[model samples]
Target: MTDASIPSDGKWIPQAMSVKYLAKAKTALRAVASGEKVDWDTSGEKTVPVEVFDEDGQRVFTAEITMNVKLN
Candidate 1:
């Protein structure tokens, strides 16, 4: 995975990407459902950091993903 950062000028600056496991899926899921207020302006969409690892326990990549939840 390629890592990059954007400045106020709005440009794609590429950087080196690294990975480290912060928590397991269960832990992350619990945190997401921790009863935080939704931001309507974003339509309940949230970005979370995730890490991918290989079967041999090797780190693959890390990235942020957007999750959308629909409420009844």
Candidate 2:
């Protein structure tokens, strides 16, 4: 699972996301910012759980992103 942490009032800077999932990540991030349910699908055989933590160390956002290969 890929994870990240963000401080309160901080913005998300895209890392290695490609064009396809980058857009989806932005949308999901927006929904998470608004406290709405995230509707995302990995659409791949493997799942990568992306977690975002608040400055207070609380979990804020979570989504199972897609990955090409499975991790051991």
Best by lDDT: 1
For every model shown, what is its TM-score relative to the native structure? 0.34, 0.32
Report how far off residue 28 is in candidate 2 (Å). Answer: 17
Q: Can you write out model 2's per-residue Cα lDDT over 1-72, one digit (the tens) per residue? A: 122222233333223332223222222232232212322222223333455554455555556543343222
Looking at candidate 1, what is the lDDT of residue 42? 30
What is the C-alpha lDDT profile of model 1 across 1-72, one tens digit per residue? 111121233322223333455544432222112123323233344444555555556445566554453332
TM-score of 2: 0.32
Q: What's the lDDT for all of these models?
A: 0.37, 0.34
